[model samples]
Target: MTPVVELSGVHWGPKRQADILHDLTFSVAAGEVLAICGANGAGKSSLLRLLYRHQAPRKGTVRLMGRDLWLMKAPEAARIVAAVLQEQPTDFALTTRQIVALGRLPHRKGFGPGTLDNAVVEAALRRMDLTAFADRPFGTLSGGERQRVMVARALAQEPQVIVLDEPTNHLDIRHQLELLALLRGLGLTVITTLHDLTLAADFADRVLVLHQGRIIADAPPSQALTEATIARAFNVTARVDRSGPAPRFSFQLHG
Candidate 1:
């Protein structure tokens, strides 16, 4: 089967022509969940931006499905890959429903919203359990609620691949698990950047560890979260155990 997303020797950075992602190559298969974990400045967010075409690579190429990302128009690319970026400001005074409805812009022919578009937006809001808050201003919602609304907006886009940056940032433990479970149920290609190693282990089919802008480890969480790999990339000693439904990790503080 053809992979849904593929990056070949991709290199990108904002300035100085220094490659934050150095010849990074990876492919995400359809219906698979791949979590990216790394320390600060490890270039995880930069990688996501490159994949979603928010920024073009300085070298190499990024492909969505079989099409070259650079060749695709911005609206066309948005239709194929939906993203939930970290701490994106909602300075606009839009309602939750209005915010979610904007996801259909890629499919809209003119400035007006259509019935089919509104139906998809409503459905997405309901799916994310935000139906009651549909009419409320987006700025009024709590952080976790706002995060769910953001995910709902992404869902409304009906994209084949979802790229999330720190999706669980403001979510409570229960909501965090729920959101991951929901993503797994969708069975779309998922690429998420997560700081929580234990959550990554529980939710991801595979984990990719980045260090200093290079992919240091790519394997199942059981193998990827080994003491050595965790220590090397995160600079923290972790104890991995298979006692639960999935492998879990506990960090050991070091001086």
Candidate 2:
């Protein structure tokens, strides 16, 4: 099967400063969840930005659905890839439903609601379990609720690929697990940056470990998250337990 997303020899950053991503290359298959793992300043978010065309690579290409991502027009690309990044306060004024309905803007022909758009918005709200809070102000919802509303908005876009940056950040364990499970069930091409190695192992079909703007490991979680690689990339000693369905890591700061 053809890959849904591909990056080859991608490099990006200020002309004078060190590149945020350097010679990074990887691909994600259709319906696969690929988790990007790294320490702070590891270029995980930069890679996502390249994929979604938020920032262009200084060198190399990012392809979505076999076409160059940068060459595609914004709305054309929006129709294919939807993203959920850190929410801003500016979004808080919109109600949960309104926030989600905004996803339909990419598909909207003119400045008026249609039956199909309304149905899609309602379905996305229901899918994200935001129906109960649909009319509530986005600022009033809890962090987990707000996160789901963001996902609902992404879903409303009807995207073929989804990209999330540190999606599980700040959520309690329950909400984190719930959100991961929901992503798994969607069966979409998912690319997300995850700070938690354990969650990445449990949720991602594959894991890519980045260090110093380079891909240090790219494989299934068990291989990519080995203790040695963890130590090398994260400067930590770890006990990697792969006896269960998913690998687990226990870490100690290395001297």
TM-score of each: 0.96, 0.96
Please give, for residues 1-255, the per-residue lDDT of candidate 2 as tens digits. Answer: 668999999999966787788998888999999999998888887788888889889999999989999889998899999999985447687899999998998898878979999999999999888899999999999888888888899999999999999888768899899989998999999999998988998899899999999999999988899999899889888899778876668999875
Clashes of each: 0, 0
In model 1, the clashing pairs are none
Per-residue lDDT value at 2 in model 1: 74
lDDT of 1 at 235: 84
lDDT string, candidate 1, 1-255, tens digits: 778999898888778866788989989999999999999999999999998888998988899988899999999999989999876556557888998987898889977988899899999999999999999988889999999999999999999999999999999999999999999999789999999998998899999999989999999888887888988888877778787877767787665
How many residue pairs of model 2 clash at the backbone? 0
Q: Report the error of model 2 at residue 139, Å.
A: 1.4
Q: What Cα-based lDDT does every candidate model obtain?
A: 0.90, 0.89
| Candidate 2 similarity to native, TM-score | 0.96
Winning model by lDDT: 1
> What's the lDDT of the predicted structure labeled candidate 1?
0.90
